[model samples]
Target: MSLVDLIARADERGLAASGLACLDRCVPLLGGDDEVLRPLWSSLADGGADGDAWGERLAKARAELDCADPSADTVPGLGPDPASGSGSGAETETEAETEAAVSDEDRAAALARRMLATAPGDPCASALRAWADACSAAALQIHRLLDVAADGDGPLVAAERRRQVAVLELLAGRGAGGLRPALEVSTEGRRVLRAVVSRRARGRS
Candidate 1:
């Protein structure tokens, strides 16, 4: 079935998992640790997205991602922290160059942040449906912005859509057990994104 159909048919848990998986996979773009969302995943497994555990874990994940704690925002995967004020001499020049280099990734990260924020803590069918739809658009847009391919329907967009559908299908088919496979799918996408970021850096140099 198509991604939309699968999402429509999915229960509250499936919808939440699908959206969280997408955002978790894209966390690398936000300079987050690979396992930052692991706790959230555990929450989903333990009691789904509407429980106290999910809320606690979600907040913890956001804090770990530097979304909750502004002081920790160091721009690990994307680029230099924008708030780091201009330095003098060579340092300033280097910062300027880095800033220019990661503009696309930064934009992509912003979209990822939006996806994370849009996720419903107390997810019901209606809320999960809206969040899932928004996440789909955000994930696609992030891929489009980060894609190095020439303008058009490139492989990156196709791959992302396929990944999205695959995650939904896995959730629909396997229930909680499917979280592991869904996470594996996200890991593969993360690797692809890391490679894309590296390729962009190489092209820049």
Candidate 2:
């Protein structure tokens, strides 16, 4: 099914996972490490039945990610991911040149931050649906902004679109069982964005 249709038809847990996965993949733009949002993901794994834990985890993730020094958001080698339940591997992104170029990257990062900031503490259906849709749009924009190749739907953006669709589909089909694979997809995207950010940072230095 199309991503929009899948999201519209999704249940509360599906909606929450959809949004979390989108933001998780874009974590690098916020300068958060891969595991920084693991707590939030864990809260979703049980299908968000525990509203209290979800809220607490959401607050904790925000606290860690909103630090002034984004580079040090998470420990380098954290324990097993709450979502993945196993070891994981990485992925890369794009950047522009002076003025406009730098603006594109900054804009991308800002969009990513907005995604994290706007995440609902309550995890209600209405709130999650809206947040999920917004995250989807922002994540795509971030990829387009940083896309090294400016061609129509560069690989970065294209892959992001696919990942978004895949996340929703996984949740739709496997329900709670889908969170693991959905998380794996987001994790790969996170590594890719980290590489892109790293390469761009190097170019500036």
Candidate 3:
């Protein structure tokens, strides 16, 4: 089924998992640890998105992402390396490069954090649908920002859309049992993104 069809049919748990899994897999873009969203997954497993444990776990995940307080509204800076030296042309170039990289990372982190923050604590069908749509847009935007390709409608965007649909379909078809397979799909995407980041770094060097 198409992602929209699958999402339209999904219950609250499947919808939530679909969005959360997308963000969880993209955690690497935000410089997050791989297991950072594990607690949220446990909450989904225990009783879906509206479970008692979900809010607390979600808060914890936000905190770990340095987005604990929504009011903070600040993106963490990627500071210049101490060893890069001071007041030299090379140092200035390095600082500019670092800032640019940080800006991309911050943009990705903000989207991921928004995906978490916007999750309905007591998700209804309407709320889940809205969240899912927003996640689809955000995930695509994240991929676009990180993509090395100059073309906006390149392979990265296409792949992200496919992954998004696949996760939702996996959940819709298999219930909670689909979580592992969904995660595996996310892992593969993460590896692809890591390679992109590495290639960018190499180009810079």
Whose lDDT is greatest here?
1
What is the TM-score of each predicted model, taking all chains together? 0.79, 0.80, 0.77
Residue-level lDDT of model 2, residues 1-205, one tens digit each, is 7878888998888888888888888888777778888887787875572478887777778788773322221112222222223433331121112333346677777667667777777667888888788778778878887888876789999999999999888988898899899999999999898898889899989
Question: Candidate 1 has which clashing residue pairs, if any?
Answer: none
Tell me the tens digit of each residue's lDDT in model 1 across 1-205. 8878887888888888888878976887778878888888888888888899987787777777767642332342343333334323245566667767766677688768767765666677888887787678778877888775768647888899899999898888899988889988988998898788778878989
Evaluated at residue 141, the lDDT of candidate 2 is: 77
Better of 1 and 3 by TM-score: 1
Ranking by lDDT: 1, 2, 3
Winner by lDDT between candidate 3 and candidate 1: 1
Model 3 agreement with the true structure over 23-100: per-residue lDDT tens digits: 876777667877888887878778888877887887777778776653332233433212223223343565666666
> Top model by TM-score, which number?
2
